[model samples]
Target: MLIFLQERRLPLSLCGWQMRNRLIYLPISSITEWFAIPMVNLRVISLAAPFVLCTSLFALSLVQAQSLPTKKKSDISAPAPQAKTVSLSNIPHAVATAFCETYPNAALVSATWVERNAETCIKLHTSEGTKTRDLLYRLSGELIEMAETISPIALPEAVKETIHEEFSRAEILSAKRLVSAAPTLYEVTLSFGAEKETLIYDAKGVLVRKVEHLPRAVQKAFEAQYPRAEILAFSKQDEDGFVRWVIESREGQSHREIVYAETGEVVAISERLFPIDLPEAIKETLAESFSGSTLITAKRLTQVQYHISVSDSSGNTMLALDATGKLLDMDAQSEHVLLSLATSPAPSQDLKAEEDAIAPIPVALPDPEVDLAVALKPIKVEEPLAAIAAEKKERPVIIVRRYYAPSLGWIPPIMRLWRPSWWW
Candidate 1:
């Protein structure tokens, strides 16, 4: 039987047997001489052929898979490393100078190095009130553009009305006042149901553009990073040939601003600040220097600067400070104005003083002894003509009454003195 099977020309129907619990047939043509077959009966070879062929195929597949070159984990491509943080030394001199010149008092919150149009550049993040400013600069430090993130309240009345008129029922998510390129405009984010819409309006509130969706990569990356963050505002910009997506989101008390490339790489990130997080040093300095002063607000202006609003006994005033909590120089007129305001008396206090000063003073009381004596002075009475005629007097008669007199003797009203009767 073995010799006959090795020939590869045996009758096709001669090999048949039960495999497992079922009958199986093995064609003679399928049996190769190279395959080792046990010296078993014809029925056994047929039964095992299918099993052996399957086993051999699986083993071959495994060997082939193992033989293929394996890729190292490090060989897998990943996104290019983005800038982490930046310092003054890493910034180009021209950029630093130009920035300082443009915004002498602007407080820098952060700086990042990014690639734009195949060239490296700097992105400076600053803050002023609820506004977060992003400035772009060339490698040579030349100013490219500046954009600010503004709150809904900062939107112009016209723009707000336009939004209201258009999306009357849509909830306004956020708004931004952009001051870049030509014609400053406003970017308003409105949400209706689960859909978010971004509308751009010019200074006059005229609709300039609308963005309903972002590039696939940018959206995917953003959603993956911040799945639960409520998107406040979104904007897109084209610098040279590179595109950037600016996204602002709020989660609970935290706020975040992210700039993304069209390729889904995060270029920069800035945490939006609130007044309650004013530096302790700033609060301490204000407390020690301006006692009884209350901090109204403290905003991050730059990486090393802050704009603080405070209310002292006088009034509310805004001042700037450096990173170390040192007071920064403000405009001469503004400094004088704020100082004067700080030193000047409050209107409420001034009014109170005026009221007290205008109050009438009480007149000095007269002497009670002199007043009583004057009131109790005696009175004199002249006799009438009829009484004088009745008395038959030849000369006019005078009568005097006194409350008290040493010269007059004490007498009851019903009795008259003998001397008084004679005088009468």
Candidate 2:
């Protein structure tokens, strides 16, 4: 069969398979057969054919070389990466609070986004509070432009474009340096373990705050970190020059207060609650749970109202107390939860756009005691300090506690603890 196929012009079908796979094969032994046809008159034909064949082969070689491996490019010269862009710039409520508290100058006084025929003017705060300005700019990558009083710097576009093209840098490292030197108004936010720290800046390129977010997850995880310490309240202190935070903790037989500087690091001292006079069992529990604190406050948390406050280097914890001395819940976090719980009866399904539209403009937020010293004035004390000191000395040294469980947001304490009363 092989001899028959080879001898009688039999088709071996080599070209058929070769065409399917697009592979070409050259036979070295066959070259001489074509030359044999040429000897008859073929000086010109022979010379031209050899040159043409060689040129075709050279062309094939070029194509094959192009099909193989490629060269490496230096990523070092590439542009910095950008964040996943978002349209709505929702400044966190906490960040808003912190901004207003720390640098009242940079606060957003009012925001008006024209909706329909009427301009919807949302006043950030009323009653001569913080001064604020909001601005818009065209931003690309790390380069920001179109600056108003509140906008970032305005440089020539060519300079900026040249910088972008020629300047290769680790944007992350650059950001770290910038953040270390000053706070950034991030295009987005970040969540750390149980807490969410959202960073924001003012027009002056100053970090306004690492605004803390307390989610349910954070509150629940709080116990795991400090098993003995209970967070009586999370405070947002609006100092004249800086923002501060304090965590009120209770330990066995004593209470401790830990204050954090603006950077969220403890800048001050940890005070111990002193001269414990609570029931022995309560004292023992406190001793087991907390170190005593110098600062203390009486809090009166009734179903209606409560004021949970923690003091400072003043060496006093002055909280208002009712007959049964249960600590009050007057901090922003508590008030937020209460207000939410109170209005939650009407579900989202019941809410309509028309109803929201018809709703009256929201009342301005009362200033946070937060900066209570600035926002509220201390009542005039006519009594002499000696007498006041005597009264405080005679009063029982007790740190009152109030437990808040979201499950029981609607329930009030059935009974209260009793303590010695003072003659106001």
Candidate 3:
């Protein structure tokens, strides 16, 4: 730097320099100040200035680099923060006009401000009837994700195809939507176009299952064993946190219900069909996986997972740890869990595959506009919508009660006087 500076000027009178750290500012226009200080040799000044100039240039460049956007998950890794949220009230009429025009058929039931932004998260109930085509829209007057209403019977074929295509023969025993303003993925039924099929999606939008349908390849293997068997529409339930599809297969009119764990591949196809006498391979596998877990209870699936309960030495139940002792239950248990936990021992109560896929399976979500800067802010609350078709699920009777006396079943004639005719 000194050599360069000297070249730029010339072999002139030596002007001494004073530096604050590495600053090379020369005190000029003051002979007294200059003469008072000994001249720093041009050679030394050159060596020192180079380091100062380089460091200063680099520091300046770093400050500028900070202004550029850092890597966003949306761009590389997982989905980053949403775009800026715009309030519905604040959206221009043109945008509102576009929404109204776009989703004219969709019934707008409720709207809430998501991310405290411009777009409104709208809920729409598209039910053909009490039992047919019930859907929950996550539409914020825009095309986003959608979820199926719980116990939505007579599901539309279009929505059903979306599920089949997505989960594609995957047994979607259950699904749910994690809390999100505009979730990229859903935990509940997968949808394409207007149709929906019961399917659970990971937070990353990976498809896990469809109701009663295991992955196609796995189903084919199961089918090979039961050649003439046809599936009698089955009901799915969570047996120890796994989505177990209790399939009723009929061959030549002989029908029997068989439970199969839902999974993409045959991770652990059961060896025995009869009431499972704990297999040594399975028991040791669970013990080794849940190293410190205390085996609590064990239930058997015909061909898949052994639902067992084991808790840590500390007494906290080990709910969904894998065969390797890894606590893998981060999200709500879907029927898809049957596969992931196949080899692991259930060390607690048989967890049900989550029926309510999520708090609310959002359908038709808003175009995400979450500003990365403001993602940490609390999400605003919306008024709860009336549950139109929330089917009541009856808990299975674990213990049967025997009636001791006939009079206990109903009040005797003497107590009938208190019971009004209307009550009867």
Across residues 1-424, which tens digit of lDDT does each residue of candidate 2 receive? 0111232343345434323323344453443464455333544564467569889999999999999977656455444433232112333344344444644544342221111123211112211221123331111112111112211124233423433453333121111112223333332133444533444444344445565654444345445646876554355555454555555555443344444444434433343323343457766666777756532322222232234556578864646432223343346445668866887766564476657678446789986557757668876666697889889889987799999654533443321111125411
- Reference-based lDDT, each prediction: 0.68, 0.41, 0.46
Candidate closest to the true structure, highest lDDT? 1
Of 1 and 2, the candidate ahead on TM-score is 1
Candidate with better lDDT, 2 vs 3: 3
Candidate 1 minimal-lDDT segment of 10 residues = 1-10
lDDT of 2: 0.41
Each prediction's TM-score versus the true structure: 0.32, 0.17, 0.18
Order the candidates by TM-score, highest first.
1, 3, 2
lDDT of 3 at 172: 45
TM-score of model number 3: 0.18
Residue pairs that clash (backbone atoms under 3 angstroms), model 1: 95-141, 107-301, 107-302, 108-302, 108-303, 109-302, 109-303
For candidate 3, write residues 1-424 as lDDT tens digits. Answer: 1311232333333444422323233444353364564344533455566579889999999999999989976467433333333343533344355555754544332222121133333322232222111122233334444444333233334445665664564554334333334543444544545554655454443555545445554376568777787653445556455555445454542334454545432322212122145788887897789879855324343333224456566764535543223344535555567687887876543344454343545689679777876888888765455232232234344788887643534666444544557663
Judge candidate 3 at residue 354 and give its lDDT. 54
